[model samples]
Target: MKKTDIILLTGLIGSIIFSNFAGFEKKLDKIEHEVLRMHILANSDTEYDQNLKLKVRDKLLENSDEIFGGCENLEEMKIRANEKLDEINDIVLDVIHANGYNYTAQTQLVNMEFDAREYGDITMPAGKYDALRVTIGEAEGHNWWCVMYPPLCIPAAEKVESDEQAAEDYFEAEELDIMKNPDKYEVRFKCVELFRGLKEKLSK
Candidate 1:
């Protein structure tokens, strides 16, 4: 190809790439804003601690209705969750004590960054999300996380057949398509994550 033709072709390709990334980023931003995440960190990686983590998760899930009941949207859920922070802490403490562990648990609301994560059939893209975070003891171990507002982790709590069904009620068709088909957007997701990482580093 001629020099002019080559330059034009390269510019065209760059524009196409930028356009696709912008579209993906916009959808991701919507998803991030509309969703609430639940993050629970274990006290340690010891087998006992890990088991305790699961127990804690179960207790929370069992009380999911109380924690999230009567919430219409993300903001309502956030307010209800905040109001119930004390109750949430008590629930965690009850689980820890019953499990014969004295680890202190702290629950709070925060905006936190998360990596791309898959739960059941849904794949959440990496981004910053508003989260209800629970830290146990030193909180140095692996963590468990899930979509809290949509009640994906606790289908029974929401009377849904599955997490995907619960998700469908909240996510738009295109957003659902993006999540249910992660392989289609793997490259775009990675690009966005890398861009965000670099941006965060630069900001710091």
Candidate 2:
């Protein structure tokens, strides 16, 4: 994702954190444990490598129907994804070689922190999330990430409904209301936005 897009998405996240402070910790606990993410890094920042990264992403998504389809919970998802690491690598290899490139791909399952991530109407809180990281060669390029288990971006990429119920899956009813209806809490949203903006500027 581009820098501008990140700021926009995280801004909405800041709004959530600001408005939902009372129950934020409880909400975060649920998110930290439930959300599963995927990140794909390119070989380099060059256009060719970046495009190759996306090609690999598409191939993985195309082949992921079964792996993600069978899993119901995070643990099951982790196990299923780990089992397919080799198969995922092979798919990436095929894409690279077919394109006359010589880069290699590696896949691993890990627990890591993720910034607030948005997919359409849903925004995940900034916290630790389980992930499948795919690095291509040097892996220094801008990355592409998505919610893997709930299949948020997958359906969007495939022109489907795109996991409209993702927030419900990860949040309690009260928190889901806060996420879906932020306008009802505008005061908190603005305060959070200002504080976050100031923090970013101070850090820079």
Candidate 3:
């Protein structure tokens, strides 16, 4: 092969790779913006504390409708969450006290980093996301998280066979495709994560 021909071929390949990465990045950004996650941290990793964490989770999930009902979009969901922060805190405290613990809980809306997580058949890509974080007492134990906006965590929520169907209303077809078929875009997800991690580090 001629040197010029080889250079052109390499350039074309690089262009294709860059284009794929950019597309994935855009889809990831959209998903992040549309989704709100719930993060609950326990006081400690002891069996008792862990069980207490779940009790708090149960109480919150039991009241998911009150906390998130009537919210149309991510923005609305966030506003409603902020408006009900005190109520949420009260619920957490009530559960803690009822469970025979003195641990205090704090509820707040915050933007934070999350690693790639799988829920049933869906694989959410790693990135920064807006989360309703509830920290219990010392918050030194393992944590639990889930999608709150699309009502994924609600027990009475609709059951869908795939990610595409589950988020069809909130995501474009191509974006849903990426999430539905994570294995097909595994490399691209990693690339996007690497770039996002670097950007976050640099910003800090």
Candidate 4:
């Protein structure tokens, strides 16, 4: 091949690769901004440890009513979460000690990817989200997760009006439709799951 032709071909290939990467990154960013998440990891897969995780989760959710109720956006919720981290830790500690379990709780805010997850009538699409992660002891067990900012973890009856309000305030029409009926967007959901997996692997 001629030298100029070779140079042009290489540049074309590089541009294509760069464009695809940029598109993927943009999608990830969009997904991250759309929702806030929560994860509670138990110490082990044992029944007692798993139950303790729920105890911690329930207590945290109960105590978070005010913070979640007032927050209007992910950034606000994250700020409130940082302010209440110590209180959350104490709650977890109390639950552990009360259950006669000697384990530690670790909490932090992080960016993590999730597959499609259903919460009653709502389904969160697969994507990277900013979350409050609470890990107990080894943190090797199956975990519980929920949307904390939209307050989906709260009782269905109590949060119904709030959730609808939040949806109207926070999400776009198409996004809200997908969350409300994810099965209707099955193909897109699967594609999101696949890309999330790819993004996770690339980051690792």
- Output the number of the TM-score-best candidate: 1
Over 15-97, each residue of candidate 2 has an lDDT whose tens digit, in order, gives: 77766653545555565686678899898999999899899889888888766676877788898888888887888899999
* lDDT-based ranking: 1, 3, 4, 2
Query: Residue 169, candidate 3: how far off, in angstroms?
Result: 4.1
Q: Compared to the true structure, candidate 2 yields what TM-score?
A: 0.73
Q: Rank the candidates by TM-score, best first.
A: 1, 3, 2, 4
Clashes of each: 0, 0, 0, 0
Q: How do the predictions measure up, each by TM-score? A: 0.88, 0.73, 0.87, 0.72
Please state the error at residue 61 of candidate 3 in Å.
Answer: 1.5
67-125: candidate 3 lDDT, tens digit per residue: 77888778899999999999999999999999899988899999998888887667777
lDDT of 2 at 79: 88
lDDT of 1 by residue, 96-151 (tens): 99988888999999999888888777898878899999999999999988788876
- Give every collision pair in model 4: none
The better-scoring model by lDDT among 1 and 4 is 1
**Candidate 2 off by > 4 Å:** 1-22, 163-171, 178-204
Candidate 4 local lDDT, 87-139, one digit each (tens) = 77888899999999889998888888777777665667666688999999999
What's model 1's TM-score? 0.88
